[model samples]
Every structure is written in structure tokens, then in C-alpha cells.
Target: MADATHSTGMIRVWDPLVRIGHWVLVVAFATAYLTEGEPEWLHVWAGYAIAATVALRLLWGVIGPQRARFSDFVTGPGRAVAYLRDLIAGRAERHVGHSPAGGAMTVALLVTLGVTAFAGMGTLAAEEGEGPLAGIVAQIPETDGPRAYTGDHDEDEHGEHGEESAWKEVHEVAANLTLILILLHLGGVALASARHGENLARSMVTGDKRA
Candidate 1:
């Protein structure tokens, strides 16, 4: 049956650029998330790589193949909700490319990951006096005062540090949110695979399904 299915000409749904972008983003995101703050260079460079990957993906979404374009898959939120409802009821239709819910997840993941990476850049600039925003973040004022407090000098010093802390917190929150989205994405893939009776994850690797 498997051979017979393959005998009929199958459509090439996922283009090479799409597949490559997907896997590279997976690796880049993993590297950035796992390293976190320590080994600052590794985390920072990983984030940069992710940013580049996403930029290319955004471009591809505009000019890629028929199945790769955002217009090919992206649908309204109402459609995504209806798809999810059918999915839960075990009556969802198999999509040659991305289903409505999957399309929604894809958009959400791309936007959130981009936000997370950009937030990291801001945090790096503010806290480490480095990254793309460094010039704009203004270096924290140096303090030569005694252990005791000075009037506005102390406020100025602490205020700079506080701004850095705020950026760091925003970065952390964005990263954590990305992590949650990833988990939800995996769950959606598993459910879709089971319902469709096809190995969706393996299809991503081979860029071919039972079509």
C-alpha cells in the first residue's frame, strides 16, 4: 500500500527553502534557549542566527513557491478555531500543506520568536553595553562615591541599572513565552499526525507525505 501510494505522482508541497528554514530555526532556537545567559557569546550569536533565519523566512513567505507562500496557508482566526474544533472531534480534513490551525501556529511561532530574539538584543545592549542597540541604551554612569548614598548621584546610578534590569526581564519573558509556544506546536503536530494517519514530523524531514 505504501509503495502504491508512492507510485502515483505526489506533489512537492514544502519547498527546499521552507524545509531548510524550518530546521535551521529549530536548531538556532534550541541553541539560544538552552544556553540562556551563561556563555554569553554562544547565546548572543545563536540569537543572531535565529534573527537572520527568521528574516529570510519572512522574505520567502512573500516570494516562495505556491505552497510556501503565506497566502497559500494563512487563514482567518475563525477558520483556525473551526479547524481546531473539528480536530478535537476527530473529523478534521487532511491538508496537503498547513491546515488552518497549523497555519495559525506557524504565524504565531514566527512572530513570537522574532520578538524574543529582538528583545534579547535589547537586553544585551542595555545590560552588557553591547549588541545592536548599544549606542542608544547609553552606558550606565560610573560611581566613585563611598558606601554611603549621595543625593541624585545614587538615583542616577540606580536608575540606569534599573533600566537594564527592565530590558532583561522583558527578554526573559519573551523567551519563556516562545518556549510555551513551542510546546503547544509539538502537541498540535502530534495530534494532527494521529488524526490524519500520517507521520507529519517525518514528512517535514523528507518533504513528502502519503499524497
Candidate 2:
């Protein structure tokens, strides 16, 4: 099935769920990245959304339609390298779904975003003592009894046990790496677009590409 296009034929490649999830992750990651350390609530919720998206994507990769499944586009590292070489040499094949290198980049981005979300959650629990793990992370000591589940404990009280700084650093590094991955992904899209004479980025929205 071809989508109407002036210059080239198009095919249904990306499914609606895949398209929606991809854009949602893009927005959620961008929101979290831009609002990091400013609005705690926004950051937390964004991270949560990212985590949720990753989960859905993982599930989709397992049981989704042909092009959306991991078995469909994922290739060996050798294949990915060959694809990159072809891309650089201007001989890359135009794929209806993701190309070999693009598939690898998708996996990398998903994993990195998942790690970023996890680290962000840990950081929130350790630093502010408030998150899904709040009750277990930064318990406050009572005057004459066992520690309370309140997250308002003094930072100094938990000390290294909280590992607040460490978790925060991990979160920051993961976020930065995710951003770098995003930049690389965009660059690859531009290069592929020019090489194949197709708007690869827009393909995600319409779920079709030159066929």
C-alpha cells in the first residue's frame, strides 16, 4: 500500500502505537532534560513517564507488528557498521522501517532513557527523600524510638547511606548521555534524509516512507 506523494511512493511502516510512543518519549525526555533541577514535580513526573514508556516499548518490541518488533530491524554490530559505511559512501538502502544503524540507535536511546529514569528516581529518593521509594530511602530518626518513615530527615543524618550525591551524579551523567544520543540520532536522520531523498523524521509522524 502506497501513500500519496508527489515524488515517491510511500508504504505503511511505522504503526500508530510506535509512532505515538516515539513522539511521547521525545517530548517527555525533552521536558525532563530542560526542567532538570528546577521543578522537582515536573522532573519526577517526566521521569516516571519515561519509565512507563520504556516499559511499553519493551513490551511492544516483544509482541508488536512486523516492523515494530526487535527481530525485524535489529541487526548484528557488523551489519550496523556496514550500514554506516554505506551511509557514509552514499550507497545506503532506503528501508521502510528503521535501517540497521537506526535500529541500533533506537535500542541505545531506549536503554539510556531507561537508565536515566531509574537514576533520576534513585536521586529523588536519596536527595529529597521523596519518591516511590521515599519511605525506605531516607527514614528520619525519632527522639526516643525507631526511625520514622518521614522524608523530612536531615541530609546529614543519613550521610553516605543515602548516597544522594552519588545517585544525583549518575542521573546527571545518564541525562547528558541521553542528550548526546539524541543529537547523534538527529544527525543520522538528516544524513539519511539527504542520502535517500526522504524526510526520515517526518516518516515517524506519518508512519510511512518512500517505498
Candidate 3:
């Protein structure tokens, strides 16, 4: 659909789905990260929300509105690097939609968040015999030993503990990476807004930019 433009020169860039999903993801990630897995139910549900939102966003990027489509802004790394160079020089071209660097950051955040969420599920499954992967991950055979029968050292009875630890490490690393990417994303947004004389964050909320 064509974006609606008004006399005030503002135009709809992000669709309602895009805008809502963006905020939902922001809240969900913050909830999951800050809780640090305490109040287990909340943390798990928040991670699930992040996963679902990212999945929907990926689909939307394929078939959404003009500005939301990946084809509109997902230029390659070379273009992103070139845009960054131009941006640093204060000579970057203005884009009503996402710039190359912005597009790259979007993709990176999506992938990193997805990894974090799924790795958390894997950790949950392997560690607690819970979550979606529980059936698969919890099926590891217990060792035929006195410790296994006595439950004296259940964690060391099989490879499950090691598997759980590995998944936990992956989840933690991915979550940390997501945090770093988020900081970089915010910095880029602030810099781009200042350089272009526009509020990029407000544009995401109002779904408008100079047109």
C-alpha cells in the first residue's frame, strides 16, 4: 500500500505492525534481560515473546509495506561500510526509510536476539527438563551407575549436565552480544538523528519522516 502523506509533510513509513512489534520487542528483551531468569515464568515468557516477534518481523520484512521490506534497504556489507564512511564524514544521503547501516544493524539485532532466545530455551530444556526442546534435550540416557540410582550426583550421572552448561554458555554469550548490539544501535540512531536533523526514534513511533 502507498504511504499516506499529509500537508504537514509527514508520511507513514513504518506500518502499525512494524511499530508495535518494535516496541514489543524492546519491552520483551528488556524484561528478559533484566530479570536474569528470576521469576522463571516471566523470563521464559518474555523470551518466547522476543522469539515470536522476531519471527513475525522476518516474515514482514519479506511481504510488508514498501519501507518495511528488506529489499528496500538491505544493501550488502560494502554499501553499509560505504554509508558508515559517508556518515562519519557528515555527507551521508538522507533516506526516508532505513539506510544501509541501519539495515545491517536491524538484521544483526534480529539474528542475535533470535539466538539468545533459542539458546535460552535450549538451556532450560537441558537443565530443567522444561521448555519446547525438553523432549529432545532431556532424552539423554542416564549412566548405569550407583550415583545415577542413588541421585547422589545426578548432575554428573550423564552428559546432560555438560550439555546444559554448553547451552547456558551459548545463551549468556548471545545475550551479551545482543546487549552490545543494542548499545551500538542506539548510538547509531542518535548519531543519524543528529546528522540528519530528525528524531529517528520518534519516527519509529509516529511512522513518519521528512517526505
Q: Best by TM-score, which number?
A: 3
TM-scores of the models, in the order given? 0.83, 0.83, 0.88
Against the reference, the lDDT scores of all candidates come to 0.78, 0.81, 0.86
Taking all chains together, the TM-score of candidate 1 against the true structure is 0.83
Candidate 3 regions exceeding 4 Å error are: 139-164
| Comparing 2 and 3 on TM-score, the stronger one | 3
Ranking by TM-score: 3, 1, 2
Is 1 or 2 the stronger prediction by TM-score?
A: 1
Q: Where does candidate 3 clash, by residue pair?
A: none
RMSD of 3: 4.4
How well does model 3 score by local distance difference test? 0.86
Worst 10 residues of 2 by lDDT: 142-151
What tens-digit string does per-residue lDDT give for candidate 3 at 23-120? 99999999999998778899999999999999999999998889889999899899999988999899999888999999999999999999999998
lDDT (Cα, tens digit) per residue for candidate 1, span 103-131:
99999989988888887777677555677
lDDT of 3 at 54: 95
Angstrom error of the Cα, residue 195, model 1: value is: 0.6
Best by lDDT: 3
Q: Rank the candidates by lDDT, best first.
A: 3, 2, 1
